[model samples]
Target chain A: DAGVTQSPTHLIKTRGQQVTLRCSPKSGHDTVSWYQQALGQGPQFIFQYYEEEERQRGNFPDRFSGHQFPNYSSELNVNALLLGDSALYLCASRLVGASTYNEQFFGPGTRLTVL
Target chain B: SQQGEEDPQALSIQEGENATMNCSYKTSINNLQWYRQNSGRGLVHLILIRSNEREKHSGRLRVTLDTSKKSSSLLITASRAADTASYFCATGGTGKLIFGQGTTLQVKP
Candidate 1:
């Protein structure tokens, strides 16, 4: 089965520009979560989407938002990005059914370079 | 706030040896998971131990969780050069998973 798939493997954007990343959850998964990994640091939780609604978010600012569609795909949007926004964006999916557990599967991630 | 913090910012070991990394958390959790990442890439899930459980083993990996102490340890036996990567501990706080700084492991063949 396909784990999790993310779009735009790499991107280049100027300051103050906006970027959108896409993710498709694994088969049978319903919950999608986003994370940002800075250089030499562990991944930080950005937000989580389930049932087409954002259920949890980290301490990040308002610039970061996400959406989950009915098909279990997710979109992560970053607005007015700054140079500090250069990092790797990762998407993770977890099953939410009777066979679901707390285990999470991650995608290859989108590398964003904000200059 | 983050819940988990791993010890020994970095570790270096020889092949065929065992490597142990420890992590400490600040709150109660449903489960604690261990993941490995190579060069800031995607994380590969290694193992997960529930709060009610004390220890678990999977292949060459072993995980131990102590709810009272709020800490966990990941032990990798017979390490190989390919095992060189950063290890992170994630604690499930309700619906969110909080991560730690992680430990960088370098195994030499």
Candidate 2:
């Protein structure tokens, strides 16, 4: 089966510009989550989406938002981007019904460079 | 703030040697998971240990979790050059998973 897939493997934008990254979860999965990982650091949770609604969120600012489609695909949007936003955006997905301990499968991630 | 923090941050080991990485979390969790990333790419799920479970093993990978101490460790046996990667520990209680800073391991041949 095809695993999770993300669009725009690499991107470059200027400060104050908006960017949108897309993700398609693994087949048979429903829940999708987004994370940001700076160079040489662990991923920081941004937000999670289920049933087209955001279920849980991290400490990130309001400039970060996401959407989950019925097909289990997702999109992460960043507004008023800053240089600090230059990092890898990761998308993970799991089946809500799988179990509480179900593991999330991650995509290859999109590398965003804010100049 | 991040919930988990990994120790050592970096490790170098010879091939066939065992490598261990530790992670500590501040809050209670339902489960802990380990993941590996190579060259800043996508993360590959390694193993998962539930809060109640003390230890688990998959292939050459072994995971131990201590709920009382809120810490976990991942052990990779007989490591190889391909095993060189960054390992991260993530805690899950709610829908979202909290990750640690991770350990960068280099296995030399």
Candidate 3:
């Protein structure tokens, strides 16, 4: 089966502009989590979507929001973007209702560069 | 917020040498997982250790967890050049995962 897939492998936007990144979870997986990885830094959890609902979220600002579709796909929306928001957006997929202990498969990630 | 901190942000060793990286988290967790990422690539799951488990092994990898201290370690035995990459430890509690800064390993030939 194919692994997790993220669209628009790379993106560029103005500081105040908004951007939308998409992710398709791995086959048979139903939970999708979004993370932001700054250069030379580990990924910071943004939010998690399960069963088309947000089940958990990190400490990110309200400007960052997400949506999960009935197909188990997900989208991350960032508004009023700041240069600090420029980072690699990673999408990880986990099994439906899988325990947190289970392993998560990650996508190649979408690189967002804000000017 | 970050849940764990990994020591010695970077490490360099020759092939056949063993590489060990440590990670320490802040709160109680249900389990901890280790992931490997090559430059410009996605993270690859290495291993997962439950809070109740002390240690686990897979191929050249060995993981040890100390829930009491909220710490864990990943050991890559007989390292190969292919093992050069960044390693991250993610601590999970409930349904959320908090990651460490990550340790970069350079296994030179």
Q: What is the lDDT of residue B51 in candidate 2?
A: 79
Q: Model 2 chain B, poorest ten-residue lDDT window?
A: B90-99
Task: Tell me how each candidate scores on DockQ against the true complex.
Answer: 0.63, 0.76, 0.68
- lDDT of model 2, residue A26: 94
Q: In model 3, what lDDT does residue B67 have?
A: 82
Give per-residue CA lDDT, model 2, range A10-86, as digits (tens): 99999999999999999998999999999999999899999999999999999998888888899999999999999
Q: Which scores better on DockQ, 1 or 2?
A: 2
Pick the lDDT winner.
2
Candidate 3 lDDT tens digits, B48-87: 8888999999999999998888889999999999999999
The true-structure Cα RMSD of candidate 1 reads: 1.4
Candidate 3 chain A: worst 10 consecutive residues by lDDT? A95-104
Order of the predicted models by DockQ, top scorer first:
2, 3, 1
- Residue A47 lDDT in candidate 3: 92
Residue B107: error of model 3 in Å?
A: 0.8
lDDT, residue A42, model 1 = 78
Query: Which has the greatest TM-score?
Result: 2
Candidate 2 colliding pairs: none
Residue by residue across A1-115, what tens digits does model 3's lDDT show? 9999999999999999999999999999999999999999999889999888888989899999999999999999999999999999999998855654567899999999999
